[model samples]
Target: MTSMRALGRDRCLQLLASVPVGRVVFSMRALPAIRPVNHLVDGNTVVIRSNLGGALASTATQSGAVVVAYEADTFDLDGHTGWTVVVTGTARLILDADRQARYERLLHPWVDEPMNCVIGIDCDLVTGYELAPA
Candidate 1:
């Protein structure tokens, strides 16, 4: 048997910080769109690098702040044990040149294309669960 345990905010954020990649859920053409991307946890926020021309960046810029969800997880399929985390919050483009430059240095995109924009998602609600052997 297996048991599921709920994780607290602190632990959830910690687990999120431990992972390098996650899926960001956002609105695209009035529909939910998800994209897998690399990220970094900065304080209570998750930061991702994207091209200025990308939908995510453009949406955030146009709306100032967009509600979004971020999910990341790791699982041991054989053992059925691992952790999953989801964060809901507002995503905004980091407008400060210095901060944007700092984030660019801290997070490198997976692709070779130019990623000139940095988006920060301020975590408002964090929920997580851990599955373990009973």
Candidate 2:
């Protein structure tokens, strides 16, 4: 086991910038669900693209934005060296067409489907840690 130190908000965001893919945790059908997604960090916001009618997109479009947790990690199983970052915040659908387009250009998803639905999560509570043997 190794001791972990807390990472500051700035450091967390910086680490996140280097990460291209993350897991988005949200609620669907009254149950918690998580999906692997590609994202782009725009300032303090994390943006993701999804199908317009998908569960993720629908949650963002609902009233009173959805509370989401975005997590990304890099680690080596043999060495156990890396960092894990988790961000919890409100997520909403990007209503502005121009802004949506900008996000789409910045984030490239693996899926071939059209990423017309843009969801942005405000990095309100950024928490991260580096894992290394003491």
Among the numbered candidates, top lDDT falls to 1
Which regions of candidate 1 deviate over 4 angstroms?
Answer: none
Instruction: Give the alpha-carbon lDDT of every model.
Output: 0.94, 0.88
If scored against the real structure, what TM-score would every candidate get? 0.96, 0.94
* Native-to-model Cα distance after best TM-score fit, residue 90 in candidate 1, in Å: 0.5
Q: Model 2, 34: alpha-carbon shift in Å? A: 0.3
Top candidate by TM-score? 1
Model 2 quality (TM-score): 0.94
The lowest-lDDT stretch of 10 consecutive residues in candidate 1 is 54-63
Residue-wise C-alpha lDDT for candidate 2, range 24-83, written one tens digit per residue? 999899999999998888899998888988888876776659899999999988887889
Clashes of each: 0, 0
| Candidate 1: tens digits of C-alpha lDDT, residues 1-134 | 77999999999999999999999999899998999999999899999988999989999988899999999999999999999999999999999999988998889999999998899999999999999998
